[model samples]
Target chain A: MICGRTPDELIRDIEGFHGFVAPGLVIGAFMVDLAREHIGQNTEADAVVETRHCLPDAVQILTPCTVGNGWLKIADLDKFALTLYDRHTFAGFRVWLDLNKAKAHPNVYNWFMGLVSKKDLPKEILIPAIFDAGRDILSVKPVTVRAEFAKREKKSKIAVCPACNEAYAAAQGTPCLACQGKDYYHTGS
Target chain B: MICGRTPDELIRDIEGFHGFVAPGLVIGAFMVDLAREHIGQNTEADAVVETRHCLPDAVQILTPCTVGNGWLKIADLDKFALTLYDRHTFAGFRVWLDLNKAKAHPNVYNWFMGLVSKKDLPKEILIPAIFDAGRDILSVKPVTVRAEFAKREKKSKIAVCPACNEAYAAAQGTPCLACQGKDYYHTGS
Candidate 1:
């Protein structure tokens, strides 16, 4: 069994980071728990999150990784999924919120089935209920990522366009798109 | 001068897309105008917005590019800048908000100097003021991007972890970080 502080304590801490308690926060907490289980508490671990939502907050709060440090990468896949990778070893795990399995939990089922709409429901009741449901719905698995992605791209040549005076990556045979260029044509002149 | 619908009509439309009228929205509108000036209204043009704030909404409203179509790529540099790229020609323009010049406009200066905080400011005063300031502050320039970043990365090998049953990219000699990994170490064993 996954062990930690009480669910109430976790939710309270999560609430402090996130403005208010909601289903997403609960789900995020559960996801972090699973990630910690698989990866251990390695400060050097990096995170690749699929969506730009509550899950990233959970990762930032519960894990050692963060966006400021460039350890957390947002893939913006628009899915509620994340991958925790070890930079040195390249070992990682991808965790996804399995909607179907999530629905198996009573609270999640009600939320999905429309028994409880998000707007009308009180968070006090909803927060803990989602926490209970999260265990059944989350899927955690292992994988590896390319070394190239972990390494940040080197800065490319940047130039200012004389006409419009904006900065852009310098490229051969390409004129500034702003002042003198057609939509489909590649020739600079 | 940018010729288009009346300023009232434009502001009304912009207000509709963005929930509230603020300096960012006005800046976004001006940025869109600059983008349109450089690159004609071609449906194939894509946009790379540097920040995840109001500028994106402006690009989405005024230009042919959008996030849904996968044409709007967000660089998330956290700067008040944007780049509009023509997919066919690979030409682009970078636009930045010039705070010094923008402050030349009275309203913009007030907002920047913290005389007018965003929260309590009324839309009627705030909207037009920002539009005026944006005209003064925004700088348009030209640039070119490498072909590699323009083209999306091809789908790589994705594998499911046997231990936890989550999907991950397959890399040689790297175990799943979830099952076995330490913090901050670089080598995968």
Candidate 2:
């Protein structure tokens, strides 16, 4: 149960951010709710989102994390999952959509099971069904993150390109490949 | 110059997909142009994009690669950069935004410089100026990718949850975590 927002209010907030509300948003909200329960009041946490999907939005909404802020890292595993790790303790929790529990909602279950292959089902039918399924269709488990990954990455050295006079990662080698020539293939050769 | 579409037309297409036009799209287009010039009809190539930003859109538009098709990999280095890798040969090229060259355009230069300073500028003035800076602010380099990254990742084994009858990655544990219980924290314990 989300503390302050009703399901309709949550959907509206998600829609405000994502331009539309869908099953992923509802599922993400539930996962974030679980994460919040475990990670109580530690706002300095970082999120490692395993997919480039709706879950990141939930993390951003529920936590003080953002890609621009470098607190959110997208792992792009394409699994509907995410991990919230405390930078100080390196303790974290991984949350995933529970395919088993998803079966209780026929629309979501069929989609996950590949029984219904349609990509563009009407939102009117899909959104409500997914929101109703809610917390029942998720798994949250505690995990520990490696210390190196939990810490913020150091900024790389920036250098000016002689030809273009633009800053680039000096570690990649300079004269800057793009400024040396337009032919991309010949640069490494 | 982009071959078929005029600059206005290209911007329109980018705007249609991205909802707004900005400098990142222009840089992405130029990168795609360089990548296309090298790869040349090898539709089997994969794109390894270094950022989760505008470059993916350009790759999706100009090439056969896409996240859904598993041909586009987001490296998430958070630099405005990308690499196009040939799946068959492991040949690739990298492109990055040239921050120094971006300075030739006063508006863009000041913005980039101020960006590091953390001054909040309004978007209306910022977006068009960055767009105007365009193709001049990029660096392209050819390189070879390691064989391992070029190869497609193996699909993980799937198992059905006994409680809900839906499939999940069995390696994480059985009965599936969500089916075991609702308490996310204690599930691991």
Point to the candidate with the largest TM-score. Answer: 2
lDDT tens string, model 2, B1-189? 562567778878766555466556666787777676676664467887765556666765556565434577665344567788677877777777766576687666655444433245555666666556656776776777666556666545556778755455566577755466522222232
* Model 1: residue A66 alpha-carbon error in angstroms: 20
CA lDDT of each prediction against the hidden true structure: 0.61, 0.64
* lDDT per residue as tens, model 1, A18-124: 54564665677777778777887743678777655566666655665544334666663444677787777778777777755866776665553346766766676
Each model's iRMS? 11.2, 8.5
User: For model 2 chain B, where is the 10-residue window of minimal lDDT?
Assistant: B180-189
Error of 2 at A130 (Å): 1.9
Provide TM-scores for the models.
Answer: 0.47, 0.54
Reproduced native contacts, each prediction: 0.00, 0.15
DockQ of candidate 2 (2 decimals) = 0.12
- Pairs in clash, predicted candidate 2: A165-B100, A166-B100, A167-B100
Q: Which of the numbered candidates is closest to the native, going by highest lDDT?
A: 2
